[model samples]
Target: MIRGLQLSLNKTQKLRLESALEQLESLSSKTNTNASVAVADTIPVNYEDGVLKGHGTSEMEGQVVATVCGVVERVNKLVYVRALRARYKPEVGDIIVGRVIEVAPKRWRLEINFSQDAVLMLSSMNLPDGIQRRRTATDELNMRTIFEENDVVCAEVRGFQHDGSLHLQARSQKYGKLDRGQLLRISPYLVKRRKQHFHHLDQYGVDLILGCNGFIWVGEHVEAKDDMVVDQTNKSEQQNANSGGSVGSDDQEQSHTSLEIRQNICRIANAVRVLSALGFMVTVEVITEIVDLSSSLNLDIHEMLGAEFYVVVAEREAERRRSSTKKR
Candidate 1:
């Protein structure tokens, strides 16, 4: 009887439960069990308001006792799904963040926080013209330009390979190269352990670029004029700063200050490793606050490690998957 689950056993279910418990005990004893407990929805369970009513499977023999944690509902002698408390492992169709590490001729291998890098193929992409096509010589030459080493792109898991490798895709419009921003990396296990997926930051006009490899980007949109001004000012300021000289123009000074702030964003984030362990959704506000406190007060935030960056990466991945599914 886990804290959230109600124990309901029928004649068949009772026997199954007993066997499962025995197996669990044996497995636990043989090896220190690191198995994550989760509710088996496919297995027959009937419960109402924390009371067991009926069972799903009649065969009790060889069934393993599985520990489940969910809102207890009892009906007859069984327990059904009330709600999902936790889940383990990434599934097909799950939009995850990953990094491109190796580029093979037919496919690109991605480090998806799993045992192996998932493969993304040239055939997987639907070209800008909306036509599905194969890899071309031009595409091969442009492959590095499209997705290089250390470049983070949002993609979908097509399926698992025969050898347990993941098959991935980035065909749709939303899934592509991310640029002009800072990326924050966090752990995948921690991200899945948390329930809430969508962390919105409508307040700041900043956009979040999320990757399963834990790399995330937070940046604001810049118009053409703004881009030119920023580039010019940045170059001027960098030269002056390197020469140990101050700029005469206030605009240059302001640009210098902004660049310094942006550069420090990565430094401050990387310095605090513990922040990634906390699993806080790293929204723009959170970044801003950290910047303010650290730069102004010089207080070290060793406590706020493992924090997650908020992005529409999940939504974009989902949309891409849906489009792929429709096409298939």
Candidate 2:
């Protein structure tokens, strides 16, 4: 009936329609908060009223819904993730990978990648039981035999102390004494965002643990027979070949070898830095790729971390000198 002309709404009808549209929009957008005031007239409220304060679940209210980017979980209100993933704050009964930096009579001091060093008490550990219990004078003398400085270890965060420092324990079957392996240190944030602890490289015969303290262990799943002998021989050969340079030693041979190593290391570090910046979780394959690239550049892997490692940068300076020579 009203073909050519439109039927205009009264003021009340227009208001009702506007309110209905606002509710519909809110419903469609999944905005849970109830709007008490008129939809259009209501001032915008901060949307991030529920974000987590730190990195994990908070008892505190109004936390934003920020979950860990990678595979992670909150178990019994405790958060855990893999290495090189983002990290939540530490909680009691958390297992962590740590390094021994200091040793004392009753407890050892450990670097667990937290703000403070954790204490590993002698009593908390499952040592030889009663009477045969307590470390003897001989055992105390050989503290290095039991645990040495720079020894990367795995332990559990038992609880906190009155002073707020963490207490650690290695009293489980899975915990304790790691043998020959390569250890890597990374940022803690990367660990909190991952799900698993160990990533098995079965084909490579390698087993790795991404420690919460940024320490990762990479080595053969099973200890290699005679690996110590092989390592020893290799070390001896390298040292013997590098020995004794007398006055004005052109050192050109050593310099060349060292430069090669530094070049490879720098390239790898650069690649890792790039990937890390891009939020890519670093893996052994990533490192291997960098090494492969270095090989393509004619770099020697054997020279990596060797005595001549510093010479690469030096050679760069030397090249500058040569260019200046040409200019002169």
Candidate 3:
């Protein structure tokens, strides 16, 4: 498991943490019988029946071998190892969050925690005006206006090009620039691919986007605006109103976030950080539960990162897993 947190614990706390981790290990062992192998380790397989090699597998001297350290999975003459800690593998239609790294002639290079920067072609995405016309040279020149460098963008994998580069598209309003949020990087394996990656917690006024590439975005929820809707009356009325009066400084005051909303964002973010440190599967359900648990205990958001909190979370997870096993 990935261990990135450094906690200063006393003797009892250390012992309890170790015990909780051991319990988690035992629970996983009870459920999964697949053997784990290291890189270059030969995977024992029947040779009489032709074996189909999958990801993380290579053939060496009539033997099947693993090129990554992970658990071996087999399915009807097909065998592969699912690597625990590897770069994100893009599949068509997978929604991913990425940062724009480069703006090329007709494409944008995005960093999505993959082996190579994924390509987002101008032709594949919709214009800011949400039109369905051909991309002209003007559009190509104005690409940066749509998505500049370092901007966080949400797009869907459009499949691979003939040159073996991954391609992405953002043709929908839901897929676009994300602002007013924090991005958290965790292990991609922890985020299991689900039907819905975009979640809006109406109760907390927060929008959560679980990127398949391990880039999680927690931000204020913004209602999706339809650019196609052209309200000329409202626009003319606003123009008339603005023409009559000078804009006051009060109107220009930045809308500051309320104290409560900021704290809620921090609490949710800390829950993610704690769960990542514990190497637990990070789902919306688990993250929400952790946030609720912390709130119920009246613990400050910063306290969630302390050694005691880590130990407590581990013990609680162990107990939860035990109860789950009993029910099964």
Candidate 4:
């Protein structure tokens, strides 16, 4: 929260941003009634009631105490701490995006903004050929052919490994290499786990993946086909390339994303980035509204990140939340 702007700001704009921030804080405090606690803080609880301690809590010297810095939560006899500003808590079935950091013996290690690198076992995912069979040494050797270092990938939390480390799986065709787009990182708390995190803005021909790990993907929309069949033409092209022939210029051009789709990707990404910076919840509706705002005003793609646009967003968000409150 800033009274001034990262870019140049006028007095009026500064005051307006400040006012909007104050309003947002007020709304937040009103709805969030849970008491916040710090690490090792003594959590007041009725000892006679046989309190059932949960995560982020510990019993010491006959008193319920917090083990982590977070808000105190209670569910009947169960009490736990909901840590804030913490690492992404991986849960089974969570959709996440990550970058491949290492190609290991039988798996890929991915940096998913978690406590530890997540393991995507080679056996866990469906191969591009859509074959269902036992994995072999040849498949292990060709792991990089499917995914290499630094390739942005979409995956789901499979479960914790026996060693307590996070594990991932990409059995579905939707979970795989992400290209022709940008990746945005924001606070995980801003993005609540939801059923539909994969969004295709058909009007703009862009895909938006709100990864539960706080990694966002905004790129050109690719149709989700049931099978990831390798085209025979592509295979022939690969063979030609292996035989010392360069790829055709037309094929190179086809690989590049169109300027319009690229612009939309940048615009949508900027909208999410701005909302995250403003400490607002990043939801599909709010993001779409912001993108529509920029389009309606005919603002340049880069202008969406300017100080004036930030002021406008702050004001608009304040009003929208205000109206929703009134309706409720």
Q: Please report the candidate that would top lDDT against the real structure.
A: 4
Tens-digit lDDT track of model 4 for 134-187: 999998998987899999999999999789989999998799989889999988
User: Per-residue lDDT for 126-178 in model 2, tens only?
Assistant: 54221226666775665565577878777777888998978988775356655
Error of 3 at 309 (Å): 1.4
RMSD of each: 16.4, 20.5, 3.9, 4.0
Quote the lDDT for 32 in model 4.
83
- TM-score per candidate: 0.46, 0.45, 0.89, 0.88
Comparing 2 and 4 on TM-score, the stronger one = 4
2 Cα displacement, candidate 1 (Å): 26
Question: Roughly what TM-score does model 2 have, to 2 decimal places?
Answer: 0.45
Candidates in descending TM-score order: 3, 4, 1, 2
Estimate, for each residue in 99-176, the C-alpha lDDT of model 3 and write its tens digit.
999999999999999999999999998765554789999989978777899999999999998999999999887898
Scored by TM-score, the top model is 3
How well does model 4 score by local distance difference test?
Answer: 0.88
Point out the higher-scoring one by lDDT: 1 or 3.
3
**Residue 308 lDDT in candidate 3:** 90
Each model's backbone clash number: 42, 17, 0, 0
